[model samples]
Target chain A: MEIAQIATIASKEFWDRIRNRWVLAVALVFTAFALVIAYFGAAQQGAVGFRSIDLTIASLVSLVIYLIPLIALVLGFDAIVGERERGSLDLLLSMPITRLELLLGKYFGLAAALAFSTIAGFGLVAIVLSAKLDLNALYHYFGFMLSSVLLGCAFLSLAVMLSVFAADRTRASGLAIATWFFFVLVFDLLLLGALVVTGGQWGGEIFPYLLLANPADVFRILNIFSLDDVRTLYGLATVFPRALADPWLLGLVMLAWIVVPLGIASWRFRK
Target chain B: MASSLPPNDAGAPLIVAQGVRKHYGNIRAVDGVDLDIRSGELFGLIGHNGAGKSTLFKMMLGLTPTTAGDIRIDGALVTGRDFRAVRRTVGYLPENVVLYDNLTGLETLWFFARLKGVSPAEAGPTLERVGLAHAAKRRVREYSKGMRQRLGFAQALLGKPRILFLDEPTTGLDPEAIRSFYATLRQLRSEGVTTVITSHILAEIQERVDRIAIMAAGKVQARGTVQDLREQVDLPLWFSVRVSKEDFEAVRAALSHLQVEAIEAHDDHVKVRCRREAKMAVIEALARLDGRVRDLTVREPSLEDVFFGFSD
Candidate 1:
């Protein structure tokens, strides 16, 4: 009911985690990666040693696509139920804020923290790549990185939703990890199993919708979203389905990842 | 603190719990209990373990769902969809008061104060009020039990809440802290804050609260002023009358005249628990018998006695 109240709650939650030790630890790790990426780029500057730009691109893809969601998971899995276990749920509930506000506050707070970390990480990467990489390429890299961070936020929102539904923090953490595991490692395997069972009858048609459901696919699409040539990466000499590889569809998928789980969490939190 | 008008003058009761019930499977935590907490008063709810005190308090805070019945605060329903509005005016302090162990006391206070919409300057005075200003810079992990209680109390008092639900607020507090805590509570009462305090320590709350409610077996068996509950105890003014060796027979014979045969004879003394009407008769009969009464100690009915008496 109170937007200011929700924002206040979010500000507290955000700053608490922002000042946490883990954020500095993440920064240290990001700094180390920047250093390594810098050296790798400088060594391959003149002659084609290994394509530092491509390595930078790969780093952007894996670091944002895979690592950030895991980071988000570690941050978000215990958001709600942990407060309940600590007996501070009573404290939060005493305020004039509604359950929707509380959940949204927590969800937004975590997303904001993850987004801030990503921005910092991107800034540090840019500082390292300034000597070799051009400004235009750096802009695209930042955009893809931002999308990955947003996807990570989507996962965090889903985790927060799971945390609310769970009876306790431990169960909530387990469910969050299981969801991340499904999206990251198990979804494709399960889909392949389904395709094998159906004998490729609906794989092409159903795969797009299913991939849209998977945030990792969206992250991967965002990584190559700003590329000048997307069709070349298909590796298929004769057949490249343009629909599955559409950048606009990737944006739609990224938007879905951000909005759908958050909507569900808000609804579940309504008193 | 809610108002400066008058004590118990508000037509709108601070808390009106009518047939407020909650059940977990077959165990009814709060079973059909009606409670009215007046304005500007410290209301004590004393009950033993599993007596549903916590359940009732939780229902008032909207922490746990009520199975049936409704609680009204200034005529707003404390159940169903409108509970959020009810929660606005209420502050709660749980028994365990577990805060973020990683943050400094000042940071924690500022965070909760910010969440409660009180300014940072407002937080400083609150911490000082609870006597936790010195330990504000220390992390919660380093805080002693009493200090954490202080912080918890300060948080609950923020924004000048009209209603406060304190669940065992002084469970492990030291004697000095308890004394100081009660002083703060009295100050809050003067400020017209309506408080519902739950505790197992009955004696500490007797003079602290304006009214008392004794709960047993998920039901409130007695609810009224200290004297009101004492009357429900239905026990007499008991006394242990001691006499000299030479006057033992005279005292025993004197008690017999007042129909005090149910005495626990201990050497030269007799302990008698009888109706209040028989007290004066026994005393006068002792005087007539010329018994040398060395000492007499009278036992009065407190909330504990009232609860256990009616609990039977």
Candidate 2:
């Protein structure tokens, strides 16, 4: 693999987002939402002000779980298929670069864009609340920002995978939306319904392990398990074993979510 | 001018395809075919929409895998490990070439130059070479169709590649741009760049390309110089003779002694159609009429006629 070739394509994709203000727009959205949730999250409970960092991160996690995946999917759903449909794929393939290199370049470029926006958007919030929070609170907020970036990368990987396998942009987009619905909305609910219908008799032992199957859940667990207050508030501390909640282990699972889909996309694109 | 001599006079074959084939399940996009393109030669591939010219072009560039056989460029298999090195020395301009609409003309060239491992600084001069330097900073979305085509050509000229593959290169160019495009091609030829071009406009490339390949029904029906193809097909030639209306019969009688195909008289001239072998004899017969033949113009078969002769 030529690093130069990959870097060239990656830089082009990254700068395209930068020049078009896609990165700026996404960062602004994240900042606006994070600030609102940080200051007004407890309003329904008859309290509104600068809340505890733990409670703020918990609310932000729920928002990111829905927002990042959708942004990532939209950002990357057209990576390969768009080139193919626009008739640029032939010219790009005709270059000296390999298909694997091109695929990796595209993935890394868009991943960088999504990661940048996630960091900038939420990092601004961390600064705003830094004076009120202690060192421990700052560390948890930093962890939340990191996990949010990973979730975006994972979903971007899936979107690129769909771009390669899909016949056109329309189909790739449809597959992307379907992927978001399944992972962000339906995966955990189906696991819960399976357990309840079986009266806890079926798949109970593997329930916590199955949560790792969804990157969104992994992101949620990664952020929630690190904070003591948020961990109990979600009631996941009882069913999700303490041993399996290691932040390092959950982080590795998130990395796998990012890598595996890209691996499949590279394979399909080579064919 | 290269057609005047034998094709081998140019150099050894730089690109060779041996029984190359590509099948899309039931459809044979490129049937078994053999071809050789010599170094520094301008070659043309012409055919109808579904004649598989594009498929064969793609296979030659390794953009599409061949179902069977092998294609080698400068002795390196297009599908093999050394293809990256081979590709580095090759340039391609795809048909209806599409570039990033969001990029400036200069940025577009730099993007391709980086991919080809060339210096981004070359983008300016390359854009100037294609007459696109004036619009270097303008986004491609604002360029006209002809300007986009020029930018695409500029991208292909990066890295000073030794070989070029152009597909329907003049699709949207004006007469002046078309003239300059071929002029640049001629300059590249002098630098020993072997170019293989495909065109739907037969007349546009007939006089420009050194040799031509006519494809039909997924096969190369004929391949050679224009003159060579005309001779192979053995189409008839036309001779228009200008004479007084009263001497029309006399002009016909002069050529009647020879094996002339047909002779018809118009208001100002008479048209004579005859076989290729009978050309010199017919000319001699017409020359014998001397004073009666006020003027004589010999018209050989056109490239279109030769194309239809073989493709049909």
Candidate 3:
């Protein structure tokens, strides 16, 4: 509840990452990936040069969905457990700060670092594409960057939650990887199997709602749905209902993803 | 601000614990422990490993919740919520704290100062106090173990706490550093800072603390001043008597009634051990041996012996 304590812890956590070059490394990864996807996005189609912002965003959407979550998970999976292993938790806890403040401060600080790197990384692509692409494409790319930060925060929350529940670093990281696999790879496959076995009868009505359950899918639908051709190309326009594709609603869902896991993390951390 | 006294000896003790217990599942880490630490007293807690020393220290700082009982610091109860305020007025130096090696010594102290809600500007002077002022700009990773310990001590000295808790503080310190460490602790005590330090190195803290508590198997086996403990344990005293070569037999024979064991019968000295109560009698016996004894010395049992005696 004490903002000063939270800010102190948060600032320390943020600077620690900055000193370790994690922020710069992640930013470089984003910039390199975005630049390549922007300049040579259609290399498979034998096309080169800055492409349409929509095309760049569509490609970047898939990239962010996989990359941001992984980055966030790795960045945060050891937030609490790492402190404990390093034998600093006792000193930290002995301070005049509450566990909630520590947990929130760590989350927000790392979230800021992740958000900063994401913006710096993708903002470069935005600037380069700004001259070539139109205002609408520019908006979509900015939206892509925002959603990417949200997804990172969500995954970071999950990572911190794992750090709290896990007994050690090894188990925390294992649970983090398992979480990534479930959301990115296994969740959709299982949903598709449920659809096939049900002959599109039992769970078909609830399929779109279920897609909203995963922050990655919510991020995907939010970005691609802004464009007609890309939405059709991605084929999510048919699966995710138009009403549920409201950017505002999906943003709320992503916000929930960020808060709910972090809330649980704080709860478990205090326990 | 808490430096002033209450005008009389009616002020509350610095720390009060009543039947404080910590149970991890079926394991009783601290069981029914009652303690009182007075203001400006430098107390020592010595126990074997896993003797619940660290656990009790943690409970005092409100780092861990007690399974039962209560602990009060400066008359304020320490709990999950209330301990936050009390923590600001206290300092702690844990055993083997691995700080952020990436930050300089000054920066590390500032970070901890900020946590304790004190001014980071105090970091420089605090480092100087711990003899790390010249190395302020050096990163902690480049410092030696002794330097790191000084940094930890510097952090604990922040805010000029009324009470300081140190757990096994001299683990890696050299003799000179240990001496200086106690000197600093004595200086703090002069300022009315009650320090509670735990160490397995009994010799290091024997003469430094005001009182000592010997813990064994989650309980305080004995608690008193070193002299008081020596009086409590019925340990035998050592006596070395110097006698001439011609009178060694007479001196030994005279002291044989006291059941003194002849450790060595040198021409100049005869060593024996006896209980403290028999000291005067044995000296009298030696005196009656025709002035054969040239010199006599009596050595009382040390704190180490008393510690082991009570621990066993």
RMSD after CA superposition, every candidate: 3.3, 3.6, 2.2
Query: 1 or 3, which is superior by TM-score?
Result: 3
- Candidates 1 and 2 compared: the better one by lDDT is 2
Each model's DockQ?
Answer: 0.56, 0.85, 0.85
Q: Residue by residue across B1-312, what tens digits does model 2's lDDT show?
A: 112223334578989999988999999988998999999999999999999999999889888889999999878898799878878878899999999999999999989999988889989999999998999999999999999999988898898888899999998999999999999999999988899999988889999999999999889999999989999999999999999999998887888778788998899999999998899998888888879889999898999999999888
Candidate 1 chain A worst ten-residue window by lDDT: A231-240
What is the Cα-based lDDT of residue A160 in candidate 2?
93
Relative to the true structure, how large is the alpha-carbon lDDT of every model?
Answer: 0.75, 0.91, 0.87
Q: Candidate 1 residues B1-312, lDDT tens each?
A: 233323346434778888888988999888999988888888899888889998888888776678888888877677656665556567788888888888887888777766666676777788889998888888999988888888888888877777789999997799999999999889888877888998888888888888888888889988888888777676777778887667767666767757554777688777787786787787777667543777888788766777788776
Best by lDDT: 2
Q: Least lDDT summed over 10 consecutive residues: which range in candidate 3 chain A? A: A128-137
* Winning model by TM-score: 3
TM-score of each: 0.90, 0.95, 0.95
lDDT of 3 by residue, B1-312 (tens): 233424214234778999999999999999889999887889999898888999999999988888899999877787745676688778899999678899999999888888887888989999999999999999999999999998988889898788899988887889899889989999888877889999878887888999999898899988989999998998988888887778777876787778564456765787788878888898788788766677889888988899889888
TM-score of chain B of each: 0.92, 0.93, 0.91
Residue pairs in candidate 3 whose N, alpha carbon or C atoms collide under 3 angstroms: none
Q: How close is candidate 3 to the true structure, as a TM-score?
A: 0.95
Clashing pairs in 2: none
